[model samples]
Target: MNRLVQQMSSTPNRRRRPDPAAGEGSGAARGSNCKNITIMKLPRYGALSTRRDDVAMTTIRVHGWPVSTWTRTAAMTCIEKGAEYELVALDRFSPEHYALHPFGRMPVVEVGGLVLTETPAIACHLDECLGGPALQPEDLPTRTAMRRWMSICADYVFHDVVRAIPRGRPASAEELAVARTALERVESLVGDGPFLAGDGLTLADLFLAPQIANAREKAPEVLDGLGAIAAWAAGIEARESFRRTAYDPASV
Candidate 1:
């Protein structure tokens, strides 16, 4: 038997209770909190379906906390690509998390039988495989720019600036200064169009949108003087994909 198949076959069946605070229309059953929700069952490897000659149906499974920004980034990308996925919530510090991600990170994606860790890689893989509106720009120069901004968000904005705010830690003066500089840079990156990489929404937008929202919630001042960035953020936030996968602490 294949490794993934053997693993799934031997896994014990379990039930999950929906979070009560998960709001209506958010897909959480209203009364499910008091009931047992069966864990989603995946077909065995041998039983996987093929629609045409050699094309098998795509199955995406996301493992992470619903409220995690990285998790939400992967979820939003899945949504944008029109791919349906199963979200398997896991405790970040648990052995199970360490098993999937050596660094004990959230939002690992399992597609078919292949596992992909890290949000940017997962998002790009889904975009390529699923064949939707391309998330990355087609032009090489624009694509490079998009990748650059994505790196900035992951390295600087997310870690140095937005990290403390979500953890309930106050931003130190130095952190705030760094964040302000990053925001100004981001503001400058915004062109005449709404998205970060010119007119079209790219992987960079998906990567930064959650972080920007978090900043808005925890440190609105980081976005204070950036009119263009605020407008860009508003546009991204209004997207259906972002709305569906947006983080809400109350819902967690």
Candidate 2:
């Protein structure tokens, strides 16, 4: 066994009392149950100065609701990078949330006391900090391509398909048609491989998964004609990260 796991196993388990100051329904509130805590020592990565020792580590705290697609993106990024994190459920309109995110976004990442907002920025920062399999391609052109897809997922696919599928409302025919066109565009961009950018998964896949998952749950027919997208979504959904972070409507 690795030294880290051994140390974790040997350490005495201690119950942590919930901080009353964390507010109701926060991650800290949920963690009030002593049994919920798991002690694992993880190595530090990304943005750490060389001056720090190799064994040094930092905590990653994610504040968001699981139902939010953007929040899922940030949480999945951490999972993909093999970093342990705490999910703190916060009301977006709450003053506490505004303090963390000026724009009142759902996901706000706090790592080692540093706060970061916006899905793309937070995901990219976590990817950099955790230093595992690279989420963003190393080459400039491929990286640019990946970023372009990310933008498309955010600007077009998400707005047209994802947002149009209301929680309890049946999708309108016009809405489905627009969503199909966006899905077709996504299909055309996919190469003959498992992921969107290429053979390996990238930030593009992470960006699209939550939105796609929402579509799959709400309007399966909208994705029927797009074979490439179906296949890509299948592989992405199979990922442990997706399974861990993807939203389940039944649970809501």
Candidate 3:
């Protein structure tokens, strides 16, 4: 989820500084090239099936922590798209994950026995597969707004959540300030809605929900102070889709 925000903020519209992890390229280069390089452009299932006649609806195995925002983001997408998948919980300190992903990242989606890394890629594929509620907005401005907020949630909220976790650590003053700013922006966008993209619930809502959940669980006070973002998050929690993908604390 932090990666998601970093990537989104690095895009053209946001015009923010390039994340070191995203590289030092210009926005255009970073956006297009980054997608091409980091993302493996697998052919759609139908395309593969038509060409080789061997494609089938194989189970998807998601490698991630149940409570992780990224994991829930991917899970919510799968559930929303009506796809069936299995979750393979991963340990951050595990040597076994070295071969699976060089960085040992979570929410790596394996479909039809082939692995696909990166949450953005997985989300895009799920949106393509599902298409009905259209997780991404079709209108240009709405699309841009949706992507922008998604990036903000990833960047500010999720990043703070990550930085706050430790044996003797809590969110710093700076981190709380950032969280407040993020909540402000979220309130501006959410504005008395049952979902992030207004009346229709979309991937944007799911993507942000888990991050908020993590914050609520670990630092309820922080979440409580931000009334609007808290309310928005509660609405998402009330949804059936979210409940199904709800994190299991004991297992995570």
Candidate 4:
């Protein structure tokens, strides 16, 4: 929803479609960080929980719309680390965000004084710096394999699953055609182990989960027939990290 949400935010107000204000970004500061203090009265979409009663316990601040794939990916990374994040709902297309991210991607994360835009980098830093079960494998070969799958999730799975999704509708035939090879490759890989990398979950699974969920929501039949991905995603969907980051469909 990164580019699509930005496009809708830029559309003419006269259009019959609901305006981006439903995302409640209009009055948001054009270029400012959430001052270090916690401001939990969110003006836009509902907050993704960081599971702490005293929200200030975390320095993790995720500036993004809840429904955006990368945004949720960042949040999931923090959750899996057992670290809390303060979600600062901001307009993805704002010039300030473009300055921070250059590419203008959703969810510019500020944590421990570092700002990250790309999902993979954000996930890796959180996984390493924050404490929790290790998402990266210990063995050198498997770790390398884990990195390989993470790259595939970014370059290939992203195009087929998340980018292929059409707003307010399911994926079209052409989009599904583009998605076929990647989905099948995932199916073949899942048969090798319980995850994309190997026996246990890794950053590979965290990176792919939201994108796969996007495909399942928009083009479920493609996944249904590829029993392996369906089964694999089902396992991921059941995780506490995934559930904690999931946005309400109505917000989309």
Candidate 5:
């Protein structure tokens, strides 16, 4: 997770409930009384899905730089699950930011006192706690496949493919070879199914899409023979969650 600057531990005094009256920044309210916590206003899905009245409404605060793929992944999870959230632009080097996440990485999710450091944990929050459309599959076999793909994404796809493209200039022949192998690996894994986890969208798709997009924009030819992967990426991009979390790279 070099992209995350190597995700490290969160503050030991981590768990915190929202204080409606809390002010801005950790200094205004640290420990158990952090600032900007608000209740969620879950929308009714009519006959298809009812509003979860028993669950406490709260605003999920995602602290991260928008340009980060993982940060966008966290935010997209909120969007897809209909969780009201606020994206707090984070400068990991700041004293306050480092206080929230000791390693100074983006995507420290704060909601109703719960502080989550890892991307998967942040993305799974709503489904696990608030009760909404499941982002993870329930079937054991499919679920196992989903987890497999997610692991591949974190371990190989991002670090191998997306990170291989040189930042300021054209990728060297060796660099493009590495990226091609990574993309081809994904292409071979994605069977005839519409998504990484069979037919449904799951954490597997969410985890892989951003990295794929990054490679496409930077070194497109690495995906030359990967029509299926490109199509899958396009479908993921079409999702409203992806669009909602899209950020201008130059702005970051």
Candidate 6:
């Protein structure tokens, strides 16, 4: 997983400081006691982080509805790793739902007092903790290729398929064209592989599966003739974690 850089920006204070107490002078002595008072406290979800002498088992708080595809992806990672976590379902899909994330989005994961917003980061952290049947490629080149395809899966495959949903049919002509171009690019990157990373299941497979599943259900015609992609999607969907976490409208 790519290490994210945390950047903090400063904003100028708009409020003016009140005049000092006439007798006490600046209220330094009076305000000193206020430091001891705890007004606002951090919200605790459940167990987070890894177990070590220095650190606690960080709580993986999933802040999204159970049915969302992104939430499913993150939850499936936790299941794959056998990591203990808590799911915090949020009703409002507004900016307030993602106060902890840099970009307001669902499925934000809070670990070791640090909030990770994207699915890839959260999945990577979980993979680190559990370390069984690791989801990432070991070599640098394969890892780079996986990350690139994973992004393609996110930005292209998922994007167009999701847009095709509300129409209650296959994607529009323009959307199909876009998906075709993206699929061709993805095929070139992943060429006739049983999985995106060649032989084994990795993050690329996990990320790509749901997008293909969505298209399969809503826009099967768009996916017709994509033999390799279809076979990979079938294998991923057959996994227990995927079956349990992925969206099923009938279950609702």
Best by TM-score: 2
Error of 2 at 39 (Å): 29
lDDT of 4 at 110: 71
Candidate 6's TM-score reads 0.69
Q: What overall lDDT goes with each candidate model?
A: 0.65, 0.67, 0.59, 0.65, 0.65, 0.57
Instruction: Please report how far candidate 4 places residue 215 from its true position, in Å.
Output: 0.6
Which candidate order results from sorting by TM-score in descending order? Answer: 2, 5, 1, 4, 3, 6
TM-score for each prediction? 0.74, 0.76, 0.72, 0.74, 0.75, 0.69
Inter-residue clash pairs, candidate 4: 21-24
Let me know the TM-score candidate 1 reaches against the reference structure: 0.74
Please state the error at residue 187 of candidate 6 in Å: 3.3
Model 3 has how many clashing residue pairs?
0
User: What lDDT tens digits, residue by residue, belong to model 2 across residues 1-252?
Assistant: 222223334656655453322111122111122112221222343442312122126667889989888888888888888877889989768898878777787788777435766666566656655656778766444554566667787788878888877778788888888888888877776654677664467888888889888888889988887877777788988989988885568887
Off by over 4 Å in 6: 1-59, 164-170, 250-252
Indicate the worst ten consecutive residues by lDDT in candidate 2: 22-31
Looking at candidate 3, the ten consecutive residues that score lowest on lDDT are 47-56
- Runs of candidate 3 exceeding 4 Å displacement: 1-56, 93-95, 165-185, 250-252
Residue 194, candidate 3: C-alpha displacement in angstroms:
2.2
RMSD of 1: 15.5
Count of backbone collisions in candidate 6: 7
Per-residue lDDT over 45-157 for candidate 5, one digit per residue giving the tens place of the 0 to 100 score: 11211124432365578888776778878887777777778889886699987777777777887665556666654554444555557776664445545656766876788
Report residue 78 deviation for candidate 5 (angstroms).
0.6
Candidate 1 deviant stretches above 4 angstroms: 1-56, 169-174
